[model samples]
Target: MIDCTRAMETNDAPATIAVPQDDALRALLAAIVDCSDDAIVSKTLDGVITSWNRGAEALFGYAAAEAVGQHIYLIIPDDHRAEEDEVLARLRRGERIDHFETVRQTKDGRRIPISLTVSPVRNAAGRIIGASKVARDITERQQSEALRARLAAIVDFSDDAIVSKTLDGVITSWNRGAERLFGYTAAEAVGRHIFLIIPADRRAEEIEVLARLGRGERIEHFDTIRQAKNGHHVAVSLTVSPIKDSRGHIIGASKVARDITERKRAEETLRRAHEELEERVRERTAELSRMNASLRQEIAERLRVEAERTQLLTRLVLAQEEERRRIARDLHDQLGQQLTALRLTLEMLNAQSADQTDVRVQIETLQELARQLDQDVAFRVGELRPVDFEERGLRAVLTDYVRKWSKHSGIPVRLHATPSTGERFTSEVETMLYRLAQEALNNIVKHARAECADVVLERSPEYLSLIVEDNGIGFDLSSVGSIGGGVGLLGMRERAALVGADLQIESTPGRGTTVIVRVPAHAAATRIP
Candidate 1:
């Protein structure tokens, strides 16, 4: 019933069985092949497929039923068929290939990159029977390798130094940036201690950085000092992160360092400039304070001088008043008596010469002449001083003066007096007031072309005031100094100052003039002996 040639072919087929002692072992081996992500296939020495696993069906888009009797070149791309021939030749010589990467064709006509391992299959007698091949798709692994290369290029060209060190502070990798920064090539720096670039005094920084890296921590922008190849110190800002292994364990540290020496120098310069500016401001303030103190002292000295001058003026005014009084007394007591005696003698002579017409006429003329001289002397004495002021009170003196002045000037004058407190003022104060009133009336007669005048004298608890007002053609008060009234106004002001009083003059053209003198109560009561 069986064909002998077909039976022989079936008996020569390679069996997919291993002589394991237990079913568990065999089941595990089967699981390994079926669960693998790589395609596993076995073929005859002549290249006919003998066995195929689930992984092979998934990889080549072919089922075991479709590929078991097929040639091994079914999955080999057309251009890569020569690779298989060489692979088979090596296998025939009992050679094994590991990770031989090449392109192979899937059932969909697309070529896929794969890594392959091939080995010669042996029979129970250790004879080479076929080749077993394992092919793994390597698309994602190739893409990952390309990305890593790009990142390495970026690190090499960075301006800031980029380096990696182990947890034990050994330098593992150094980029071109690190080489330029530290003046060391990667060949020289790698495998050396990372502290080689750190300044001697700052070696402790490396210890701390390594300690932190061991704890899987990142340090960002830590400013510290480092050393260049020339032994000069450089200020640097460092950022360090933990470098991890494939198992996510911290294996080393990655660092980026930027030089900041110029920034530090600029900060120091700005600090010095700020300090100098503050010092200058303080010095200027002190100088201004000194100037202010000096100005205050100068002003105080000027005030003292003004006070002394005022005192001297007051004494001089009192002396001048005394001299006027003395002159008035001499004229009244001595010259007045002499003139009376001379007039009486002339009258007696005229009486004796009554019978002689010529002698009587001459005696009468001499008597008349003596009388006129006596009157003239009395008038001059009154002009020199107010003798009646000493004998009479201020009101009486003022009344007599105003009456006489009104009679002489033919000007109507009114007087008003009110003594609120019956306090008699000092003689000096009374004299000054009388003199001021006299001067004011004289000014009215000379300067104010008016018809009527008024005099007011009042005494209050705080002060004594005298006002002399005239209903006359007023003059410009501002121009009074340039006008002829300046001298009289000056004298009035001087007298007011001597008695510590205030003098005010108010006037306008066509309106009237008012002269007022106010003496404080304390000053009026003060007697200057």
Candidate 2:
């Protein structure tokens, strides 16, 4: 009887339905939950955690076993718990919380900002059973948005023009500096072409730069002079970079512009000032040179006049010598013969009157007077004419004069000369050269306590050089000796110049003295009248 009742109950019970399709649907749902990166969680109407997916464990650092039995309020901060309840309450009322952004604490005590999409979980009877939420970590995106805000603030407050352009040459961004530079606000410039700020003539160059940017090229630090709204030119240094899309496709250009008009103006002003300064310096130099030349010309002219005076004085002295020569010749030819004849007569009378004692004495006295007069006349004639030189030429003249000087002073003298040298020099050159040599030798004899002296003359094709050197107690050349001590060097130098030559003197105290005269050889060569 109990077996028949069990069979009757089993027969009345419905057969078990097939569950293969439900198993397949559950597998698909599990795959979706495992694959999602966002945390997908469901909570009961009372705020108990009902479901936790893998993304929830990764996001909150809690596994399903740990979080499923807990209230969702655990992740909500104390300050935000009330708002979170209201959000869940609204979600349970079949309302959606679409992209509600809020901060939730992670299991590691980090407050993470998230974007949450919450909706109602419904039962088969269409009654709300719980709330489901899709939460995505939006911390990085929020930080990035804050960074962009700070960068924009910096660009807006900058003093330099910061502009951006589209690949089509339209202005997409204009900062405060750009508004000041081009006299246009962001409102007026955004959709306008960049060429609005460019001058008509310079637009082409800017166009070319933009075209290059469109081709994915960057122009860094491109310097150009651009026109301002006031028609004045402003020099600018521009750095442009290619703007790219998410896939790195060149889209437009971003540019930073710096105004360098002041620098350029300062440079131009400096250049002009430098040119003016140089011109002034050149003018002053030219004025100084002209003044210097004038002074030199005046000095030269004065020297020439003085030289003429010296030559005239020399001519006067020569004229006086000529007169003396004439007088000496007359005395030798007329008075010399008369004196000789009278002296001979007196000698004859003295001899003939020797028998008369008184007469003979008077005659002897007369004869002595006549002989003394004749001697006086001959001496005067000899003084007027250099008789030794008349017979012996220049070498004898110098030798005899030097010998006499040596004898008078008891100073030893050495003489050296070439006989052939006398034949080559004209009268004037010979005279000047002889005088210069004599004057140099005289200086040595008078002031130079010299042990030895050398006088040399060299005649070459172009010039004649005369050198007089002495191993003497030399004086300082700077000290110029006593005014009268050795002006002879100056006289020699002057004579050298009169003949178109130069004189050089080298002397150091306690060393030696050398006087050199370099004269053109042809200076005194005879010219046909």
* Top candidate when judged by TM-score against the true structure: 2
lDDT of 1 by residue, 1-529 (tens): 2222222121222333323457776566556666666788878888899888887889889999999999988888888988889988988888888788899888999888888877788776777888877788888898899999999888989988999988888999998888777898999999999888987778877888888888989999999988877787888899999999899999989999988888899989999999999999899989989998998999999989878878887787767768778898999999999998898888888888889999998888888888878766775577568445445667788888888878767799999988542345688778788877877887787888889999999888788999999999988987767324524777678778877899999999999899989999888873323
Q: How many clashes in candidate 1? A: 0
Per-residue lDDT of candidate 2, residues 1-529 (tens digit)? 1222222121122221122247666565556655567887878888999889888899998889999989998788888898897897686567877788998988988889988877777665667777777788998999999999999999999998999888888899999999898788899989998888788888889889988887888787788977677787789989889999999998889999999888779989999999999999999999999999999999999999988877875675466458768989999999999998998898888888878999998888888888878876875575455233334444555566566545544556666565444444555555566666666777786788887777666656776666878888887878784313533565566666656778888888888788887778678563332
Per-residue error for 53 in candidate 2, Å, reads: 0.9
Q: Candidate 1: worst 10 consecutive residues by lDDT?
A: 2-11
Q: Give candidate 1's root-mean-square deviation (CA, Å).
A: 18.7
* Each prediction's TM-score versus the true structure: 0.44, 0.49
